[model samples]
Target chain A: MELFEEQGFEKTSAVQIAQRARVTTRTFFRYFPDKEEVLLADADADAVKETLVQHLLQKPDVTDTLQAVTRTLADFDWEKLGPRQILRQRDAMIASDPRLLERELIKQQQLTDALRDVLCRRGTAPDIAELAANTGSQVFRTAYRKWLEDNNDGDLTTITENVMSLLAAIMARGPVPATAARLP
Target chain B: MELFEEQGFEKTSAVQIAQRARVTTRTFFRYFPDKEEVLLADADADAVKETLVQHLLQKPDVTDTLQAVTRTLADFDWEKLGPRQILRQRDAMIASDPRLLERELIKQQQLTDALRDVLCRRGTAPDIAELAANTGSQVFRTAYRKWLEDNNDGDLTTITENVMSLLAAIMARGPVPATAARLP
Candidate 1:
């Protein structure tokens, strides 16, 4: 991370990262295929998604699949990934580079798909699972971004709840006239 | 679409597509830079986002940002791009190709950003605008995918409303215990 930040992501090499870590280049290849993967690695994404799914699966009630999904995500020890500053830098790097952003989005979609599948296995209706999973993830994403941006003040779960409330309020505002006419 | 399905996306060539359409290859390049763009073009994406933003701007009530966002998307004459069958084919091709899927996801993010910006300009609080825009786009995405799959029976607006109702129910069921304690 220090090297990537210093020399820029594009300029850094996998061998340099390995050497800095005191590992052989071959060892680095075993863990991550490329330097980009070192920063935006899929290595941990699967494990994280699985951990979240297992947490959601063990929840007392998932009838509120959205709550369960968002809570599971928000409640995770995200600090385990790294300090907020590092995560923010990682995100900024991904945002600035299209390839990294694409990979990040793919990782997000995979997480959403995993959440949807777990909800389905828990016996929520398929369509409901899909909607709740997608909506909850989106809500969490907004909260997560804000939590990262706010420096030190806000809590993730509270921000998530507030975002959920905003979503509810938005829905409560009733449909626009054009589509309302068509709704049964 | 037929050529892509028959020959496979990777195997098909832009020159073949242009020739089949009885247009010069230069004309094709002018319209779409490559074969992938021919399938998932950003050329139309910007225009569509601008159109949707304008539609939302014209609505009688922008306070219901979610409704306005989803309705603006669902109410668009999607057939203007192509018939449902051709659109579905395009989507399938994109889904099967990683490059195409990355382009599609990027396009989706751009649309979401545009919606958020439009809501902000309409006087919405920034956080609420972000959440509503993301949530609304997610809901519309669920509906759109289902609409594509459900052969002959569903209207996009109705499906979107159903998905929104599912979201409302999910939120109403209340938060799970762990996060509830964290919420005020």
Candidate 2:
């Protein structure tokens, strides 16, 4: 991240990165195939995806697709994904560059696809599965963003639960209406 | 689109496209800078953004943010964005490939950002604006997919309205409950 911030991603090479970390170039290559991978690295999406799929496939009784999806998602231990501070830095770097941001969106879409696939396999209605998967990811994103802002030690699971509870309340209340006619 | 379908997008050359259309290379370049632009050629996102921003700024009292957003969105004539058949083809080409899919996601994010900006400018809470913008875009997407699958002459506006109405009813009912033991 420091290298990226200082010299931009395109200018930084693997050898420089390896030397900065006091690791051999061969060691760096063994860990990361390319310079881009150093920033894009994260196995968390697959981890969360496998967990959600297993949970849904094992217990089809969770008829409420949204609840089941949310439960599975909220239970994820984010630590297994990566270090909290590094993950945050990775997100920040991704946001700072359009190409990286596109990669992030691609990752998000992958998660959505995983959720959608599991929902469909559980015999959830196609349309409902689409909505549930989308909503689950949306809630997860909202919670993740909040978690990043709150504190370094913030618990993502608790934050996710809060996000879902808030969403339920908001939907129940519906959109707030204006007092009078106001469109031009 | 026929050219793209015949030969993959990457394989098709601007000169060949120009020759097929009986236009000079200069004419082709004048219209599109590259081959990819043939698919992502529309400025539809900006046009809708402008309309929504103008409507929101002029009539802040139109309370119900989703309602207002959808109404403004529905008012757009699909023809203005591009020919119906061509738009469908463009969407198909985008969906057929992962790189194009990423571009589509980036476009969707751009629209969301525009909606978020206008909503925040109108004094809506930032977080609420983010959620509303995402929901509005999701509804737009659902309507678009249905329109593509339905009759060729279907009106996008009507489809959008139906989507929004369906969403309202679904939200009112909430998610279905599980029939068996819930997740631990």
lDDT per residue (tens digit) for residues A27-61 in model 1: 66765557776665456788898899899889988
DockQ of 2: 0.14
Please list the Cα RMSD from the true structure of every candidate, rounded to 1 decimal place.
8.6, 9.3
lDDT of each: 0.77, 0.65
lDDT of 2 by residue, A56-173 (tens): 6776465666666666776666656566765665566566556557767887888787878888877876766776677767767777777767665767776766665555443334
Query: Which 10-residue window in model 2 chain B sums to the lowest lDDT?
Result: B175-184
Q: Which residue pairs show backbone clashes in model 2?
A: A178-B63
Which has the greatest lDDT? 1
lDDT score for residue B142 of model 2:
74
Candidate 1: lDDT of B93? 58
Regions more than 4 Å wrong, model 1: A1-37, A175-184, B1-40, B175-184
